[model samples]
Target: MRIVVPAGGIGGARFLRGLKAALGIGADLTEDDPTITVIGNTGDDITLFGLRICPDLDTVMYTLGGGINESQGWGRAEESFAVKEELAAYGMQPTWFGLGDRDVATHIVRTQMMAAGYPLSAVTEALCDRWRPGVRLLPMTDDRVETHVVVADGDGGRRAIHFQEWWIRHRAALPALEIVSVGAEDAKPAPGVVEAIDEADLVLLPPSNPVVSIGSILGVPGVRAALERATVVGVSPIIGGAPVRGMADACLTAIGVETSAEAVAAHFGPDLLDGWLVDTADAGASVEGVTVRARPLYMSDPDATAAIARAALDLALELKGDRP
Candidate 1:
């Protein structure tokens, strides 16, 4: 019962925790009986202070490894910010992003590995070696595919900023004119990404940021085509005209899609998505060629989130039956 998931940061990681719980896998499970393979979005990877900081991938790894900060939903638990504070004392630029001391160690290791001529996929695997996140996590691409947001400057000019700058610095307050994947046109899916999708019994799209998260992974060459041949089910990030978490509404609006479960499902479309799960509030929503199911999508706790994961898996199986 292999499952493939295209995921972003916090939301994706949390949903995966639930998925593991649903599969009766413990957080400390170190065995290779991984039924899940997570293809993490690397578009949010940024080079800061000469260290490569993969926010999305690290978030997933930490969360699944039981080292994630529970309240903030990112960064390391019991983290200290002495390094960031010292850098600020030195009057560094772009001090808006927070990097804790413990988290910086990860960036250091990743950067060192990358500097030694290791691709991000290999670096990620090496890092995961210590964390041993239950799932077989893979980066969406080994290439440098960054998500840049084109925003109007105060001087009435538009400039593209890294997704982190727009998301962390301005909190997506500036309206994004366009969300561009800087290298997606030439990026290839990571080594095992396509194979995971092709050999999966089911593929799940967690409720992450559609534009820069799951959307970025799909933008990688051969990913969407592979998905078209798999049984894929997506859990809606939007519920009742609002995002369940994060600023996904802004991302959707930038792409000219309405912030609704139905709109998002239609955006993914029947071509790649076989089934869609929306919150109970959106039970009336429907897409053209996708089977829709309604359930409580709020992942308030492990139990609640596991229930949602079960529902999504069940829906995917049901849809697979309808396919020829």
Candidate 2:
């Protein structure tokens, strides 16, 4: 089946790995395998030290490419930070966001290619040639779109900061007064993004941050409309009234949505999502006009994660069958 997944960083990457396993694929993918296209969220893309860094894209690439650090769930495995130390010795600002030596090479390559006038979609394709992530990964938009969080300035004022800074530096400690997707108003969906969704037999939304990750992808001009016409199912990031990981409650609060499986399903609404999956802990959860089912959501291992992915795929297929 042709599947399209709109994903964020860690959670999305892990879910994608499980999806691959569920399809019975091994480490190396071959021709005649199922087609899965991943529309990676790029709203968290940032330029640091004159190099562009696409965190979500890299996480998905590294995770699926079998180069991910299992413990951290992000960054390259066996990675070192010699470059970061030298930069700090030179008194480079923003030491909080450290770039590992191995990871910096990717940013350098991407920066050089973009300087040579290649759009991010082309750059990502070239990078994937090496990782061979086994899926067609595309950025949500080639245009610069960033998620900025508005936070209290500590002086009784409010200020806007990049989402990464707010996430990494402040740890989402300060409440978010607002979350804005800067430049989304004019940004078009990246190449192949609309077609992937339009031509998909099923679309999956992994357990990613609803506000910044999936929300940012949908914020792109035509992505939501395309998804609305497809069979879409989402795994709830919220479990037992709290997020499975990350401070998604803070993000949900920023947008005035409750941190619950039912609420998130309701936020996406029946118009876009055909089915929703929540943890067995949240068994009785329900959403108006959307099919909700209970399942184990924690991706403890490859086997468990694959089961979750299989459940979502089955739900989408069932919903597709129910449609005219």
Roughly what TM-score does model 2 have, to 2 decimal places? 0.98
lDDT of 2 by residue, 11-43 (tens): 999999999999976657778788999999999
lDDT of 2 at 252: 97
The RMSD of every model to the true structure, in order and in angstroms, is 1.2, 0.9
lDDT of 2 at 131: 93
lDDT of 1 by residue, 1-324 (tens): 899999999999999999998888875665655489999999999999998999999999999999999999999999999999999999987699899999999999999998999999999999999998889899999999999999998798999999999999999999999999999999999999999999999999999988899999999999999999999999999989999999999999999999999999999999989999999999999998899999999999989999999899999988888878
Per-candidate clashes, comma-separated: 0, 0
Worst 10 residues of 2 by lDDT: 24-33
Candidate 2 Cα errors over 4 Å, as ranges: none
